[model samples]
Target: MRFCVSLFWLLSISSLYGQTAREIVQAADSKMRGNTSQAQITIQTIRATWSREMTVKTWMKGTDLALILLQSPAKDKGIVYLKRKKEVWNWMPSLEKIIKLPPSMMSQSWMGTDFTNDDLVKESSVVNDYDHSIVGDTIIDDRNCYIIQMLPKPEAAVVWGKLLVCIDKKDFLELHTRFYDEDGSLVNTMNASDIKTMDGRLIPTRFEMIPAGKPNQKTVMVYKAVMFNRPLDDAFFTTEKMKILND
Candidate 1:
Protein backbone atom coordinates (compact mmCIF):
# COMPACT_ATOMS: atom_id res chain seq x y z
CA MET A 1 0.00 0.00 0.00
CA ARG A 2 2.80 2.44 0.84
CA PHE A 3 4.59 1.76 -2.45
CA CYS A 4 1.40 2.28 -4.47
CA VAL A 5 0.72 5.58 -2.70
CA SER A 6 4.23 6.87 -3.42
CA LEU A 7 3.98 5.97 -7.12
CA PHE A 8 0.62 7.67 -7.41
CA TRP A 9 2.01 10.79 -5.75
CA LEU A 10 4.91 10.91 -8.14
CA LEU A 11 2.64 10.64 -11.16
CA SER A 12 0.38 13.33 -9.81
CA ILE A 13 3.31 15.68 -9.34
CA SER A 14 4.54 15.06 -12.85
CA SER A 15 1.15 15.84 -14.34
CA LEU A 16 0.86 19.01 -12.26
CA TYR A 17 4.21 20.25 -13.45
CA GLY A 18 3.28 19.73 -17.08
CA GLN A 19 -0.05 21.48 -16.67
CA THR A 20 1.54 24.41 -14.84
CA ALA A 21 4.00 25.05 -17.69
CA ARG A 22 1.28 25.19 -20.31
CA GLU A 23 -0.86 27.43 -18.13
CA ILE A 24 1.99 29.84 -17.65
CA VAL A 25 2.63 30.02 -21.38
CA GLN A 26 -1.07 30.57 -22.05
CA ALA A 27 -1.30 33.39 -19.52
CA ALA A 28 1.79 35.13 -20.87
CA ASP A 29 0.55 34.86 -24.44
CA SER A 30 -2.85 36.26 -23.49
CA LYS A 31 -1.27 39.21 -21.73
CA MET A 32 0.81 40.16 -24.74
CA ARG A 33 -1.92 39.54 -27.32
CA GLY A 34 -5.42 40.57 -26.36
CA ASN A 35 -8.49 39.58 -28.35
CA THR A 36 -7.76 42.43 -30.76
CA SER A 37 -4.82 44.83 -30.96
CA GLN A 38 -3.89 47.92 -32.92
CA ALA A 39 -0.53 49.59 -32.72
CA GLN A 40 1.76 52.10 -34.36
CA ILE A 41 5.23 50.60 -34.50
CA THR A 42 8.69 51.68 -35.54
CA ILE A 43 11.41 49.30 -36.65
CA GLN A 44 15.05 50.37 -36.73
CA THR A 45 17.63 48.20 -38.43
CA ILE A 46 21.24 48.89 -37.53
CA ARG A 47 24.48 47.61 -39.03
CA ALA A 48 28.18 48.41 -38.92
CA THR A 49 27.89 51.23 -41.43
CA TRP A 50 24.24 51.87 -42.28
CA SER A 51 20.99 52.26 -40.40
CA ARG A 52 17.39 52.53 -41.53
CA GLU A 53 14.11 53.18 -39.77
CA MET A 54 10.54 52.63 -40.83
CA THR A 55 7.12 53.09 -39.28
CA VAL A 56 4.06 50.90 -39.66
CA LYS A 57 0.48 50.45 -38.53
CA THR A 58 -0.50 46.98 -37.36
CA TRP A 59 -3.78 45.31 -36.58
CA MET A 60 -4.13 41.83 -35.15
CA LYS A 61 -7.18 39.80 -34.23
CA GLY A 62 -6.64 36.73 -32.10
CA THR A 63 -4.16 34.25 -33.64
CA ASP A 64 -5.83 33.89 -36.99
CA LEU A 65 -5.55 37.29 -38.64
CA ALA A 66 -2.90 40.06 -38.79
CA LEU A 67 -2.31 43.04 -41.06
CA ILE A 68 0.67 45.38 -41.21
CA LEU A 69 0.90 48.48 -43.40
CA LEU A 70 4.05 50.44 -43.98
CA GLN A 71 3.56 54.13 -43.13
CA SER A 72 6.78 56.02 -43.52
CA PRO A 73 10.01 56.84 -45.41
CA ALA A 74 8.09 57.90 -48.54
CA LYS A 75 9.57 55.16 -50.72
CA ASP A 76 8.31 52.12 -48.81
CA LYS A 77 4.89 53.47 -48.02
CA GLY A 78 1.74 51.53 -48.99
CA ILE A 79 3.51 48.17 -48.65
CA VAL A 80 1.50 45.68 -46.66
CA TYR A 81 1.77 42.20 -45.21
CA LEU A 82 -1.25 40.19 -44.27
CA LYS A 83 -1.59 36.84 -42.54
CA ARG A 84 -4.91 35.09 -42.58
CA LYS A 85 -5.17 31.63 -41.03
CA LYS A 86 -2.30 29.65 -42.54
CA GLU A 87 -1.72 31.85 -45.55
CA VAL A 88 0.61 34.86 -45.79
CA TRP A 89 0.63 37.51 -48.50
CA ASN A 90 2.57 40.63 -49.32
CA TRP A 91 1.37 43.60 -51.31
CA MET A 92 3.79 45.87 -53.16
CA PRO A 93 2.26 49.12 -54.30
CA SER A 94 5.25 49.92 -56.46
CA LEU A 95 4.92 46.71 -58.44
CA GLU A 96 1.12 46.58 -58.23
CA LYS A 97 1.36 42.91 -57.26
CA ILE A 98 0.35 40.69 -54.39
CA ILE A 99 2.82 37.91 -53.64
CA LYS A 100 1.76 34.85 -51.71
CA LEU A 101 4.41 33.72 -49.25
CA PRO A 102 5.05 30.03 -48.89
CA PRO A 103 5.96 28.12 -45.74
CA SER A 104 9.58 27.91 -46.84
CA MET A 105 9.78 31.69 -46.98
CA MET A 106 8.97 32.10 -43.32
CA SER A 107 12.66 31.84 -42.46
CA GLN A 108 13.76 34.62 -44.76
CA SER A 109 14.74 38.03 -43.46
CA TRP A 110 11.89 40.43 -43.02
CA MET A 111 12.61 43.70 -44.85
CA GLY A 112 16.35 43.11 -44.46
CA THR A 113 16.05 43.12 -40.68
CA ASP A 114 17.20 40.64 -38.05
CA PHE A 115 13.63 39.46 -37.63
CA THR A 116 12.15 36.83 -39.93
CA ASN A 117 8.73 37.00 -41.52
CA ASP A 118 7.55 34.44 -38.98
CA ASP A 119 8.67 36.68 -36.18
CA LEU A 120 6.82 39.75 -37.37
CA VAL A 121 3.63 38.22 -38.67
CA LYS A 122 3.61 35.33 -36.19
CA GLU A 123 2.82 32.65 -38.71
CA SER A 124 3.13 29.97 -36.04
CA SER A 125 1.71 30.56 -32.60
CA VAL A 126 4.02 30.02 -29.68
CA VAL A 127 1.20 28.95 -27.44
CA ASN A 128 -0.43 26.56 -29.88
CA ASP A 129 2.27 25.43 -32.30
CA TYR A 130 4.83 24.47 -29.69
CA ASP A 131 4.82 22.19 -26.69
CA HIS A 132 5.86 24.00 -23.53
CA SER A 133 7.86 22.72 -20.58
CA ILE A 134 9.38 24.46 -17.61
CA VAL A 135 13.10 23.79 -17.79
CA GLY A 136 14.05 25.90 -14.80
CA ASP A 137 13.83 29.38 -13.24
CA THR A 138 16.13 32.34 -12.90
CA ILE A 139 16.41 36.09 -12.40
CA ILE A 140 16.44 38.56 -15.28
CA ASP A 141 16.55 42.32 -15.04
CA ASP A 142 16.18 42.01 -11.24
CA ARG A 143 12.93 40.14 -11.67
CA ASN A 144 12.16 36.52 -10.93
CA CYS A 145 11.37 34.53 -14.06
CA TYR A 146 10.38 31.06 -15.21
CA ILE A 147 12.44 29.59 -18.01
CA ILE A 148 10.32 27.70 -20.46
CA GLN A 149 11.54 25.62 -23.41
CA MET A 150 9.35 25.18 -26.47
CA LEU A 151 9.61 22.52 -29.16
CA PRO A 152 7.68 22.84 -32.36
CA LYS A 153 4.99 20.32 -33.11
CA PRO A 154 5.64 17.89 -35.94
CA GLU A 155 2.87 19.27 -38.15
CA ALA A 156 3.37 22.96 -37.42
CA ALA A 157 4.93 25.08 -40.15
CA VAL A 158 7.58 27.07 -38.26
CA VAL A 159 11.14 28.13 -38.84
CA TRP A 160 12.75 27.84 -35.44
CA GLY A 161 13.84 24.41 -34.36
CA LYS A 162 13.78 25.33 -30.69
CA LEU A 163 12.84 28.32 -28.57
CA LEU A 164 13.69 29.07 -24.97
CA VAL A 165 11.79 31.90 -23.34
CA CYS A 166 12.28 33.64 -20.00
CA ILE A 167 9.03 35.07 -18.69
CA ASP A 168 8.84 37.18 -15.57
CA LYS A 169 6.80 35.84 -12.68
CA LYS A 170 5.03 38.97 -11.51
CA ASP A 171 3.66 40.24 -14.83
CA PHE A 172 4.37 37.27 -17.09
CA LEU A 173 6.41 39.42 -19.43
CA GLU A 174 8.63 37.60 -21.88
CA LEU A 175 11.90 39.19 -20.96
CA HIS A 176 14.24 37.19 -23.17
CA THR A 177 14.06 34.53 -25.85
CA ARG A 178 16.68 32.46 -27.65
CA PHE A 179 15.91 30.91 -31.01
CA TYR A 180 17.82 27.94 -32.34
CA ASP A 181 18.16 26.34 -35.73
CA GLU A 182 17.73 22.71 -36.66
CA ASP A 183 21.43 22.03 -36.17
CA GLY A 184 21.13 23.23 -32.55
CA SER A 185 22.97 26.42 -33.38
CA LEU A 186 21.81 29.70 -31.95
CA VAL A 187 20.18 31.87 -34.58
CA ASN A 188 18.94 34.89 -32.74
CA THR A 189 18.20 36.40 -29.34
CA MET A 190 15.25 38.66 -28.67
CA ASN A 191 15.07 40.89 -25.60
CA ALA A 192 12.07 42.82 -24.36
CA SER A 193 12.21 45.94 -22.21
CA ASP A 194 10.60 49.31 -21.49
CA ILE A 195 7.49 47.99 -19.84
CA LYS A 196 4.60 50.41 -19.60
CA THR A 197 0.85 50.52 -19.32
CA MET A 198 -1.03 50.72 -22.60
CA ASP A 199 -4.72 50.26 -23.14
CA GLY A 200 -5.14 49.38 -19.46
CA ARG A 201 -2.48 46.67 -19.65
CA LEU A 202 1.20 46.46 -18.90
CA ILE A 203 3.50 45.22 -21.68
CA PRO A 204 6.95 45.55 -23.10
CA THR A 205 7.12 48.36 -25.62
CA ARG A 206 10.70 47.96 -26.78
CA PHE A 207 12.03 44.79 -28.41
CA GLU A 208 15.43 44.04 -29.90
CA MET A 209 16.48 41.14 -32.09
CA ILE A 210 20.15 40.26 -32.31
CA PRO A 211 21.44 37.63 -34.67
CA ALA A 212 24.24 35.32 -33.60
CA GLY A 213 27.78 36.21 -34.79
CA LYS A 214 26.53 39.50 -36.24
CA PRO A 215 28.56 42.14 -34.45
CA ASN A 216 27.00 45.58 -34.19
CA GLN A 217 23.94 44.36 -36.04
CA LYS A 218 20.49 44.33 -34.53
CA THR A 219 16.87 45.23 -35.16
CA VAL A 220 14.94 47.35 -32.68
CA MET A 221 11.17 47.57 -32.61
CA VAL A 222 9.36 50.14 -30.55
CA TYR A 223 5.66 50.39 -29.99
CA LYS A 224 4.78 54.05 -30.23
CA ALA A 225 1.10 53.57 -29.50
CA VAL A 226 -0.97 50.53 -28.59
CA MET A 227 -4.62 49.72 -28.12
CA PHE A 228 -5.96 46.31 -27.12
CA ASN A 229 -9.31 44.57 -27.33
CA ARG A 230 -10.56 46.95 -30.01
CA PRO A 231 -13.26 45.95 -32.45
CA LEU A 232 -11.89 44.73 -35.79
CA ASP A 233 -13.64 43.19 -38.77
CA ASP A 234 -12.67 40.01 -40.60
CA ALA A 235 -12.59 41.90 -43.88
CA PHE A 236 -9.69 43.94 -42.66
CA PHE A 237 -7.27 41.02 -43.16
CA THR A 238 -8.32 40.27 -46.72
CA THR A 239 -6.09 40.93 -49.76
CA GLU A 240 -8.36 43.80 -50.77
CA LYS A 241 -7.56 45.63 -47.55
CA MET A 242 -3.85 45.16 -48.11
CA LYS A 243 -3.99 47.37 -51.18
CA ILE A 244 -5.97 50.10 -49.48
CA LEU A 245 -3.51 52.57 -48.00
CA ASN A 246 -6.01 55.09 -46.69
CA ASP A 247 -7.99 52.71 -44.55
Candidate 2:
Protein backbone atom coordinates (compact mmCIF):
# COMPACT_ATOMS: atom_id res chain seq x y z
CA MET A 1 0.00 0.00 0.00
CA ARG A 2 2.86 2.37 0.71
CA PHE A 3 4.42 1.63 -2.67
CA CYS A 4 1.16 2.53 -4.45
CA VAL A 5 0.90 5.84 -2.62
CA SER A 6 4.47 6.78 -3.48
CA LEU A 7 3.94 5.91 -7.15
CA PHE A 8 0.83 8.07 -7.35
CA TRP A 9 2.61 11.01 -5.74
CA LEU A 10 5.53 10.78 -8.12
CA LEU A 11 3.26 10.69 -11.17
CA SER A 12 1.31 13.68 -9.90
CA ILE A 13 4.47 15.71 -9.46
CA SER A 14 5.66 14.83 -12.96
CA SER A 15 2.37 15.88 -14.52
CA LEU A 16 2.34 19.17 -12.65
CA TYR A 17 5.87 20.02 -13.78
CA GLY A 18 5.03 19.28 -17.41
CA GLN A 19 2.01 21.59 -17.30
CA THR A 20 4.01 24.36 -15.72
CA ALA A 21 6.73 24.25 -18.38
CA ARG A 22 4.23 24.42 -21.21
CA GLU A 23 2.37 27.27 -19.59
CA ILE A 24 5.59 29.25 -19.27
CA VAL A 25 6.36 28.76 -22.94
CA GLN A 26 2.85 29.73 -24.01
CA ALA A 27 2.91 32.94 -21.99
CA ALA A 28 6.28 33.97 -23.42
CA ASP A 29 5.01 33.34 -26.92
CA SER A 30 1.93 35.44 -26.34
CA LYS A 31 4.04 38.28 -25.04
CA MET A 32 6.04 38.29 -28.26
CA ARG A 33 3.20 37.70 -30.69
CA GLY A 34 0.01 39.50 -29.85
CA ASN A 35 -3.32 39.27 -31.65
CA THR A 36 -1.88 41.58 -34.31
CA SER A 37 1.41 43.45 -34.51
CA GLN A 38 3.33 45.88 -36.66
CA ALA A 39 6.88 47.00 -36.31
CA GLN A 40 9.68 48.96 -37.95
CA ILE A 41 12.97 47.09 -37.61
CA THR A 42 16.57 47.51 -38.56
CA ILE A 43 18.86 44.54 -39.26
CA GLN A 44 22.63 44.70 -39.13
CA THR A 45 24.89 41.96 -40.40
CA ILE A 46 28.44 42.15 -39.08
CA ARG A 47 31.51 40.31 -40.32
CA ALA A 48 35.22 40.49 -39.68
CA THR A 49 35.80 42.71 -42.72
CA TRP A 50 32.52 44.42 -43.53
CA SER A 51 29.05 45.20 -42.25
CA ARG A 52 25.72 45.65 -43.99
CA GLU A 53 22.43 47.10 -42.83
CA MET A 54 18.82 47.22 -43.95
CA THR A 55 15.54 48.53 -42.58
CA VAL A 56 12.17 46.87 -42.88
CA LYS A 57 8.54 47.09 -41.87
CA THR A 58 6.70 44.01 -40.68
CA TRP A 59 3.13 42.99 -39.99
CA MET A 60 1.89 39.87 -38.32
CA LYS A 61 -1.48 38.41 -37.34
CA GLY A 62 -1.87 35.36 -35.14
CA THR A 63 0.71 32.62 -35.83
CA ASP A 64 0.01 31.95 -39.50
CA LEU A 65 0.24 35.29 -41.28
CA ALA A 66 3.21 37.64 -41.62
CA LEU A 67 4.51 40.12 -44.16
CA ILE A 68 7.92 41.78 -44.29
CA LEU A 69 8.80 44.68 -46.56
CA LEU A 70 12.31 45.87 -47.23
CA GLN A 71 12.49 49.66 -47.07
CA SER A 72 16.13 50.50 -47.72
CA PRO A 73 19.10 49.63 -49.94
CA ALA A 74 18.53 50.72 -53.52
CA LYS A 75 18.97 47.26 -54.99
CA ASP A 76 16.62 45.40 -52.65
CA LYS A 77 14.12 48.15 -52.01
CA GLY A 78 10.43 47.43 -52.37
CA ILE A 79 11.01 43.70 -52.03
CA VAL A 80 8.47 41.84 -49.91
CA TYR A 81 8.13 38.47 -48.25
CA LEU A 82 4.77 37.11 -47.30
CA LYS A 83 3.70 34.16 -45.20
CA ARG A 84 0.13 32.94 -45.60
CA LYS A 85 -0.70 29.91 -43.51
CA LYS A 86 2.09 27.42 -44.32
CA GLU A 87 3.20 28.84 -47.66
CA VAL A 88 5.86 31.51 -48.08
CA TRP A 89 6.24 33.76 -51.09
CA ASN A 90 8.70 36.43 -52.14
CA TRP A 91 7.93 39.40 -54.34
CA MET A 92 10.69 41.20 -56.19
CA PRO A 93 9.52 44.54 -57.48
CA SER A 94 12.51 44.85 -59.76
CA LEU A 95 11.79 41.60 -61.50
CA GLU A 96 8.01 41.96 -61.28
CA LYS A 97 7.82 38.32 -60.26
CA ILE A 98 6.65 36.29 -57.29
CA ILE A 99 8.57 33.22 -56.19
CA LYS A 100 7.16 30.55 -53.97
CA LEU A 101 9.68 29.11 -51.53
CA PRO A 102 9.90 25.35 -51.33
CA PRO A 103 10.04 23.42 -48.08
CA SER A 104 13.67 22.51 -48.72
CA MET A 105 14.70 26.16 -48.65
CA MET A 106 13.29 26.77 -45.20
CA SER A 107 16.61 25.84 -43.60
CA GLN A 108 18.67 28.30 -45.65
CA SER A 109 19.74 31.75 -44.58
CA TRP A 110 17.40 34.70 -44.94
CA MET A 111 18.81 37.68 -46.91
CA GLY A 112 22.43 36.72 -46.20
CA THR A 113 21.88 36.96 -42.44
CA ASP A 114 22.67 34.51 -39.66
CA PHE A 115 18.95 33.85 -39.21
CA THR A 116 17.36 31.07 -41.26
CA ASN A 117 14.19 31.44 -43.31
CA ASP A 118 12.36 29.47 -40.64
CA ASP A 119 13.60 31.88 -38.01
CA LEU A 120 12.09 34.90 -39.73
CA VAL A 121 8.96 33.45 -41.32
CA LYS A 122 8.29 30.99 -38.49
CA GLU A 123 6.44 28.32 -40.41
CA SER A 124 6.87 25.84 -37.60
CA SER A 125 4.75 26.29 -34.49
CA VAL A 126 7.01 26.16 -31.43
CA VAL A 127 4.08 25.55 -29.12
CA ASN A 128 2.58 22.72 -31.16
CA ASP A 129 5.50 21.14 -33.00
CA TYR A 130 7.65 20.35 -29.97
CA ASP A 131 7.21 18.76 -26.57
CA HIS A 132 8.37 20.91 -23.65
CA SER A 133 9.97 19.97 -20.33
CA ILE A 134 11.51 22.09 -17.61
CA VAL A 135 15.08 20.87 -17.48
CA GLY A 136 16.44 23.26 -14.81
CA ASP A 137 17.07 26.94 -14.04
CA THR A 138 19.66 29.59 -14.80
CA ILE A 139 20.41 33.31 -14.69
CA ILE A 140 20.41 35.38 -17.88
CA ASP A 141 21.18 39.09 -17.84
CA ASP A 142 20.79 39.04 -14.05
CA ARG A 143 17.25 37.71 -14.37
CA ASN A 144 16.17 34.33 -12.96
CA CYS A 145 15.02 32.07 -15.77
CA TYR A 146 13.49 28.67 -16.37
CA ILE A 147 15.58 26.55 -18.68
CA ILE A 148 13.15 24.56 -20.78
CA GLN A 149 14.11 21.76 -23.15
CA MET A 150 12.11 21.35 -26.36
CA LEU A 151 12.34 18.24 -28.50
CA PRO A 152 10.58 17.99 -31.84
CA LYS A 153 7.72 15.57 -32.19
CA PRO A 154 8.59 12.59 -34.41
CA GLU A 155 6.04 13.52 -37.08
CA ALA A 156 6.50 17.31 -36.86
CA ALA A 157 8.31 19.09 -39.67
CA VAL A 158 10.92 21.03 -37.75
CA VAL A 159 14.59 21.85 -38.39
CA TRP A 160 16.09 21.77 -34.91
CA GLY A 161 16.80 18.52 -33.10
CA LYS A 162 16.65 20.09 -29.66
CA LEU A 163 16.26 23.53 -28.16
CA LEU A 164 17.22 25.00 -24.79
CA VAL A 165 15.17 28.10 -24.15
CA CYS A 166 15.78 30.37 -21.16
CA ILE A 167 12.64 32.31 -20.31
CA ASP A 168 12.80 34.86 -17.52
CA LYS A 169 10.66 33.98 -14.54
CA LYS A 170 9.47 37.46 -13.58
CA ASP A 171 8.18 38.66 -16.96
CA PHE A 172 8.31 35.44 -18.99
CA LEU A 173 10.63 37.02 -21.52
CA GLU A 174 12.71 34.78 -23.75
CA LEU A 175 16.14 36.06 -22.87
CA HIS A 176 18.23 33.35 -24.56
CA THR A 177 17.90 30.28 -26.76
CA ARG A 178 20.26 27.60 -28.07
CA PHE A 179 19.45 25.66 -31.22
CA TYR A 180 20.93 22.21 -31.81
CA ASP A 181 21.07 20.27 -35.02
CA GLU A 182 20.09 16.66 -35.64
CA ASP A 183 23.59 15.49 -34.72
CA GLY A 184 23.24 17.15 -31.30
CA SER A 185 25.65 19.90 -32.32
CA LEU A 186 24.92 23.45 -31.25
CA VAL A 187 24.10 25.33 -34.45
CA ASN A 188 23.12 28.78 -33.31
CA THR A 189 22.54 30.97 -30.27
CA MET A 190 20.04 33.84 -30.02
CA ASN A 191 20.23 36.43 -27.28
CA ALA A 192 17.71 39.12 -26.50
CA SER A 193 18.36 42.39 -24.67
CA ASP A 194 17.40 46.07 -24.50
CA ILE A 195 14.15 45.58 -22.66
CA LYS A 196 11.70 48.49 -22.98
CA THR A 197 8.02 49.20 -23.09
CA MET A 198 6.66 49.09 -26.63
CA ASP A 199 3.06 50.01 -27.34
CA GLY A 200 2.34 49.77 -23.60
CA ARG A 201 3.83 46.28 -23.18
CA LEU A 202 7.29 45.35 -21.96
CA ILE A 203 9.45 43.47 -24.45
CA PRO A 204 12.99 42.87 -25.60
CA THR A 205 13.65 45.31 -28.41
CA ARG A 206 16.96 43.93 -29.59
CA PHE A 207 17.94 40.43 -30.71
CA GLU A 208 21.32 39.04 -31.74
CA MET A 209 21.66 35.80 -33.68
CA ILE A 210 25.11 34.21 -33.73
CA PRO A 211 25.99 31.06 -35.63
CA ALA A 212 28.24 28.39 -34.14
CA GLY A 213 31.95 28.39 -34.99
CA LYS A 214 31.63 31.90 -36.44
CA PRO A 215 32.75 34.17 -33.70
CA ASN A 216 33.24 37.17 -35.99
CA GLN A 217 29.88 36.90 -37.71
CA LYS A 218 26.50 37.69 -36.25
CA THR A 219 23.25 39.49 -37.04
CA VAL A 220 21.52 42.08 -34.89
CA MET A 221 17.92 43.18 -35.16
CA VAL A 222 16.61 46.21 -33.35
CA TYR A 223 13.01 47.14 -33.18
CA LYS A 224 12.53 50.84 -33.79
CA ALA A 225 8.78 51.05 -33.26
CA VAL A 226 6.02 48.61 -32.50
CA MET A 227 2.22 48.61 -32.23
CA PHE A 228 -0.03 45.79 -31.18
CA ASN A 229 -3.57 44.86 -32.26
CA ARG A 230 -3.52 47.20 -35.21
CA PRO A 231 -6.52 46.00 -37.16
CA LEU A 232 -5.07 43.59 -39.73
CA ASP A 233 -6.94 41.14 -41.93
CA ASP A 234 -6.08 38.06 -44.00
CA ALA A 235 -6.24 40.09 -47.23
CA PHE A 236 -3.16 42.02 -46.16
CA PHE A 237 -1.02 38.85 -46.32
CA THR A 238 -1.84 37.92 -49.92
CA THR A 239 0.62 37.84 -52.81
CA GLU A 240 -0.96 40.80 -54.53
CA LYS A 241 -0.65 42.93 -51.44
CA MET A 242 2.98 41.91 -50.99
CA LYS A 243 3.92 43.40 -54.35
CA ILE A 244 2.31 46.71 -53.55
CA LEU A 245 3.37 47.10 -49.93
CA ASN A 246 5.64 50.06 -49.28
CA ASP A 247 6.85 52.21 -46.43
lDDT values of the candidates? 0.92, 0.92
Question: Number of the top candidate by lDDT?
Answer: 2
Clashing pairs in 2: none
Q: List the candidates' TM-scores in order.
A: 0.96, 0.97
* Stretches of candidate 2 exceeding 4 Å from the true structure: none
Candidate 1 global lDDT: 0.92
For every candidate structure, what is the RMSD over all alpha carbons to the true structure, in angstroms? 1.4, 1.1
Worst 10 residues of 2 by lDDT: 238-247
Worst 10 residues of 1 by lDDT: 238-247
Q: Estimate, for each residue in 1-247, the C-alpha lDDT of model 1 and write its tens digit.
A: 9999999998998788777878888888888789999999999999999999999999999999999999888899999999998899999999999999999999999999999999999999888888888889999889899999989899987898999999999999998999999888999999999999998999999999999998999999999999999899998789988887545
TM-score of 2: 0.97
